[model samples]
Target: MHPQYKADKPIDCPICSMKLVKFEPTPNGENKPMDSMPGMDGSSSSTSSQASNNTIYVDPQRQQLIGVQFAKAITKPLSKELRVVGKVSFDETKITHIHTKVTGYLENVFVDYVGKPVKKGDPLFTIYSPDLVATEQEYLLALRSNKELSKSSFEEVSFGSSSLLEATRKRLKLWDISDKEIEELEIEGKAKRELTFYSPVDGIVTERAAFGHGKFVNPEMDLYSIVDLSTVWIIGEVYEYEMSFVKLGQTVEIEMPYSDKKSLYIGKITYIYPVMDAKTRTAKIRIECKNPQYTFKPEMFVSMKIKINLGTHLVVPEDAVMDTGEEQYVFVD
Candidate 1:
């Protein structure tokens, strides 16, 4: 038996009835000293433990295995890009409402359908009003009276007939009659039962109240609403905290939803609504964009991005910062 493994008393194997040799257990044919392990009382190990508490040390192999990366902090110009959802809408300034100046019945609708584009002076509908016909007849009668009285030797009779004719022509003009129509009436020497109404501006018909022909229309009724799509507005809601960054004339990028196109629409911030939405805590901003192609339609969902220069800032990797529920912190190397 080895002297290092010798026991204080002799022990015999039960089966062999002979003295048995005792030995210490060895793992992998070696025994290690406990003090040589980590967290031991040795000075070197103690220092390493203390340093590890303040610093993280990862070997190249471990770092590669964990996919760790590093970045440097530097001073540079920075800009914050705020993203928000917006809606496309019509430019109200270019909208025109078509209304009848006199009570009438819609005799015929030339530009009959909603969304149909019309130009200035294009015939929209013809209206039949008894009062309008009466006015036309009165003007014709006054013109004939003037012609007959012009031969009267008395100058007063000639002047009075000229005044009556002038008054009658002015009344027809007040009723929205175009000068061309009145001139044609004088040449033809007749009054038509219906007068055709023309569009006042170039635009698309957005709303139409005159559906069926011969429907009674009053001066108060809106017969048609036309909006010019050459210019449009994109209205976006921005958070109150981000309102300070918004400014008039700032250019923004707009992206349409569910579109396969990669190019974004560019718009300029034209107006910022003074009031904020109480429930949403956001303010409204209007961005005006040109729609010469007539691609943007009203009520379309869109996304907008506005970039604001924040000047110089200390920049770091986004992953370097840690955000706690109540606060934010970062680890320094």
Candidate 2:
């Protein structure tokens, strides 16, 4: 067998079953250097080849000519990085679902479309709730009675009237009536037939359940969903084997493959979903990112890399190992 090629001890060709033969080099300087096969070292013309039981000796010239390289095995901090596909999602903690406390017919709708930007106090819709109007009327009647009885000779009578007025005022407030509206009611001495609802926060309306004018609605009906995209969530998945490296509050690098900037965004893992996908066998992790300029949109796909330190360990070049099916080996020199 040649020093560089693997062969069975019986010295027979596996394919043709031909008996193998061995040959030695000719007299020195008698022949040009033989061509070398790819992956195998180039033939050395400087000196004849020499081999022992399991190792071959190649001179420095031939080793350098074939681009043979060496790397020192060392102990160093190591980290494993996994690139994964992630999708943008709404930060559930920052989402507000608009629901009415009163049952009534929608009188007017201001925020009628999804994707509309709204401020914290922007009016969302108005409802003509007979119940709301009735409560306001009761407040006005109590207000008038309290004034008329304040000068009463009996302290009990005056106190009772004041108590009734305060109770009615509290009821309206409980129904989500703004203090400004209550003051307007006091000045006007009348109840508003249509009670307007306003947005609770500055956000974009990702969902709107506009029931239309004159359509009856109740507390069970979801009127709108305002999402504050200034802070968003990214949902990513990692293989089960990589789950050990992930942790809550771990920082991750996020990149949008479709974006022109190719900029990297930073985020922290806020949640690790308990559900493991049966098909993909991956666990979902939620990362919270500040969406400056509303950069991330729901359902937008992005790429992310999760890096986890593995402490100190010895390492070698990837090219060092050569696998032979059942076993693996490497050339020492």
Q: Over the stretch 175-267, how does candidate 1's per-residue lDDT look in tens digits?
A: 999899999999999898999999999999999998778799999999999999999998999999999999999999988768888668899
Clashes of 2: 0
Candidate 2 residue runs with Cα over 4 Å from true position: 1-70, 322-333
TM-scores of the candidates are: 0.74, 0.77
Instruction: Give the candidate number with the greatest TM-score.
Output: 2
lDDT of 2 by residue, 168-211 (tens): 99999889998999999999998889888988899999888875
lDDT of each: 0.84, 0.83
Model 1 segments more than 4 A misplaced:
1-73, 150-155, 314-333
